[model samples]
Target: MGKQMTEMLKGTLEGIVLAILSVRPAYGYEITARLREQGFADIAEGTVYALLVRIERNGLVGVEKVPSEKGPPRKVYSLNVPGREYLEEFWTTWGFLADRLGQLKEEGK
Candidate 1:
């Protein structure tokens, strides 16, 4: 990943994961794949798992262990009520930041 992209992702990765989960439940591997498919190709698999652990610890999401055909049970994650609320806040914050940045960019032009 480019330095700029990596720096940009630092603060936004959690919200990105939450946004993904908000759409549907997914396991760690699935989440990683989805992120990659969505253009976050540089995100590491372990990073997603670490975020999952943090969110689970913080009561933001719920987990279910489902049997996987290829291996052991997969721990699927879905957004909980708190997670939904958090995601809403994230969007609000993101929008505010984006608007401010756009204004600054326009001013610089």
Candidate 2:
């Protein structure tokens, strides 16, 4: 994808990642695979990891090491109480912005 599109998509990456984790906890690679399968292939693999680190640092999510039978133990991430609260706030704000955008588009027509 071009730089502009990638930049545009960046803003939503955190929300998308958080939303996925909300359904179930997952490690980095699993999250990347799920995002690709769900049509977010344009997102670079590193971007997801970076976002995860940022979210964790922000105290919105927490991580724990889970032993893997086949390979090294993996760090699994899940939403914490703060994460759920942030997600709720994000949903409300996004919903309002989405409705306003739709109305503006209709008016422009």
Candidate 3:
């Protein structure tokens, strides 16, 4: 993706990460891999780790340390109550924006 897509991703990435965690708890690398599988090839592992730290600090996620086979233990993050509420708000706002944009596009046609 280019600059514009990257910029847009910055605004919604937190909500996206929360949505990912709603399904299952995962660590930073796992989240990055999931994002890539979802077509977000430009999302870096470091970025996900930073976001995870932020959300953890904000009390949006519950974390547990799970020992890995090879490396150190990984901190698996799961969406908490506040995180789910935030995700709901994000989707509502996204739907509003999408509707407006769709109408604008249709008018331009």
TM-score for every candidate vs. truth? Answer: 0.95, 0.88, 0.95
lDDT winner = 1
**In angstroms, how far off is 28's CA in candidate 3?**
0.8
Computed on alpha carbons, the lDDT of every model, listed in order, comes to 0.94, 0.87, 0.92
Lowest-sum lDDT 10-residue window in model 3:
2-11
| Full-model lDDT, candidate 2 | 0.87
Query: Over all chains combined, what TM-score does candidate 3 have?
Result: 0.95
Ranking by TM-score: 3, 1, 2
Better of 1 and 2 by TM-score: 1
Error of 2 at 7 (Å): 2.6
Taking the tens digit of each residue's C-alpha lDDT, what string does model 2 give over 43-63? 778888899999999998889
Answer with 1 or 2, whichever has the higher lDDT.
Answer: 1
Candidate 3 regions exceeding 4 Å error are none
User: Cα deviation in Å at residue 54, candidate 3?
Assistant: 0.8
Please report, as a residue range, the 10-residue window in candidate 1 with the lowest summed lDDT. 3-12
Residue 29 of model 3 has an lDDT of: 84
